[model samples]
Target: MQRLVKIEMSLFKDILSGISGIFSGSPYRIILSAENKKFYLNAYKGAGAIPFAQLLNKYPQLGDLSVWVNYEKGGTVIPLGNLAYVKKELARLISEEQKNKPEIVIPQEIQQLKPSKMPAGFEIRYSWNDSEKAIQPQLRGEYWGEGTYVSENSYWNMPGFTENDDLWLRKNKIRGQEILEFLRAILPQWQRRSLPVQSEVVLEAEPACTIKINRVRIDSVTCEALWRVNPGSIAEIPSLAGYIIAGSSLGEGFNPAGLPLQTESGQALVEEYIPKTIEKVNEFLLQQHHLGMLDMFQPS
Candidate 1:
């Protein structure tokens, strides 16, 4: 009897991947990335047999089946044994997921885009022949958080998104001159609006809400970019957490809580929060270099 042991894995970018092999014959398991675009395996595992004993030693959780390896680039293989053990572990995974289904907070702006009546418990399952089932709901009307569907359609309203800005940038190929031009265009707006002190100012880019350019003075005003967000690139809406540029110097904050803003209706209030967080950093930078500010100031 030949049974295939398949191991599902999760990769960076919220990409779902898997590894499969003949459980008994080969000592090695071949790993594939989620997009199936690339192949990778542990160098040690490829050189020889997978060291179950050594792995069990390093990860004592394997010994008692009480814990599983949960490293950054890590995943668990399907257990080979009695059906009872398999069933029990599956139940435990499900229970854990149910208990800790992280709450998704949609911003008020996005929430308004949802349909008045959402279909309850009616998940649209996809099949090769049932393509029509996919297109019908969107035709009825669009709503935020309605799960995956075919084609590029979003009900959430992102006022900050600039149409084709990324496409233009990519096609033009941003270089030294392009970067300078971008800075120049944004600087005057900063001067007029006092940008770093303002929570949100649109940088001239595709999907404008995702990026911001700030100018703060040390001795003289230095250009600082803040609130860099790219939620649209991900498959899942719930994973849209991003970092803030904090402190007097141009550096990122290490706080795990991340920026406390929700993206709803596809609009993230990073623009709203940018000014609030950057104000203090700008002040600190000014004070730290106030004495020799003019001498150190360099205009770009």
Candidate 2:
């Protein structure tokens, strides 16, 4: 016999209303690293460390707050007041589940600050696998064919670059480091691959904003399956894996100094395996659908 479960909308709304204030508003962007499975809170310029500590105290499951002290660069900071609001909001949302009652209120100070500016020198690198060449150049001058093309002339492409294909490599450059730092805060159990400890800092007057992206190529089969199922959504699939692989490669499994490898044949093998896995997973999902499992989980 199958058991049926129902979720009430009113309860969900009550819970959302309760917790809406807690997670809302920008308190130093909270990023969750999938591989590390840790939540990181970035503190803006001149921000006190106390607010972050209070945030963790309110929601201990978010892991320790790794304070990234930004100065001169001048980014936004989540003040203590905002943190209190977020805590109150989250408490309201969670309390509706018949859980613990909310014991917090939004502090007046948090409501005072203007929204923080976008953090500079930071860009989110998403994955694409259509082209057979590097969309961006590598730091070591090694050419590895990966990534996709975004044309300036095309409505889809980002501006500035010429209307042609760009190369993307998988390596740790400045942009990659930024991404790494962002991921480290979000994912629990996520670790970076070990690299040789360097004694000196390589400072270039014009720091290259490019990030090498030697991401493990997913099996072509998996890519095809993902494409077949989601079609235009293939970009999303690799991105999920990229975050997982990036953090795991850097922090936890650090012996290789590169992204972790799932198979021996490298990209070719991954391209082959992922499609089948996706197919199987998709089939299972379909079966669940037919069995009314989806309906059972749906909120009423």
Candidate 3:
């Protein structure tokens, strides 16, 4: 006997939120790697990770979601066409079921709707026991630099909260020291070390930016710096694998090292402002260079 299941809204939250743009009826394809599978699987355990081509073949009804699985390159690609029609069909099915408040019904349990086949190129290498034994990400300490620096003066003191202010000021100092210590710990060992610093600015409702400085040397003059802002926070910058965020070269003596802006601003922003920000970031890096920070990347 077929069972009727009322779909939960939360089950499809991510899929709906992400797939909405496809409804424009524009065709699109997405290629996902094994690492990508792990990330999505971790986020949506119920949906699980399956090969795109295999999935479509098993559920021929989802033919509109064309897919290709490449074994050589270890990737699965999904092409979304007739997306608008798919949305319409889904809406109609939901409407036809129990017509009271617009709920969708399926023949089997909702969780059972997981992809039946693993994508051709990828496999779940880790078992449940292995995952439980995997190393967890470590919590990083925060560093407050200029924000914590205060001069001993009345102007620097807040009214009616001297003690709290002083304590924060002290905490900032502690963070500054911790920042240096953390940097020392993660410093990469490489020959021909030179520091490369880069920054990205996200112009949202609340403007925010991040500056990354790599401290591992890869060449005689180019080194990588480990840079992160808002460490251990929700907005922490993701680790970029096999990607160099920025490139730099040693500057002439008495001159600051040259660094370039590594940001992608949407076309909306004025073009002229981009260079001005690059200049500002380079100037900031130059200040740090003069303070012997860049020396840490030199071959020991």
Candidate 3 residue-wise lDDT, 1-300, digit = tens: 112112233334434554544444222222221122110111111233445555445434445434221233444322112223333454554455331221222212322332222223321111111122211111111111221211111011122222323332223112223322322332221111321111121112221234343232332222222233221121211121111111111111111123332233211223444344335545444644544544432235
Q: Model 1 — which ten-residue stretch has the worst lDDT? A: 1-10
Per-candidate local distance difference test = 0.27, 0.27, 0.27
lDDT of 2 by residue, 92-154 (tens): 544664333322322222222222322233233323122421112222111112221111111
**TM-scores vs. true structure, each candidate:** 0.15, 0.15, 0.16
- For model 2 the local lDDT of residue 226 reads 11
User: Model 1, 1-300: lDDT tens per residue?
Assistant: 000011122322122111222322332332222122111222113234344445445434335433432223343332111212433443443355332221122122212222222233323211111222110111222212212111122122222223433232122122233323433453344346432212121223332122232343333232332333432321111111121222111112222133333232222324455454444334433533444543233233
Better of 1 and 3 by lDDT: 1
Runs with alpha carbons beyond 4 Å of true place in candidate 3: 1-48, 52-58, 67-86, 89-300
Shift of residue 105 alpha carbon in model 3, Å: 12
lDDT of 3 at 177: 32
lDDT of 1 at 173: 22
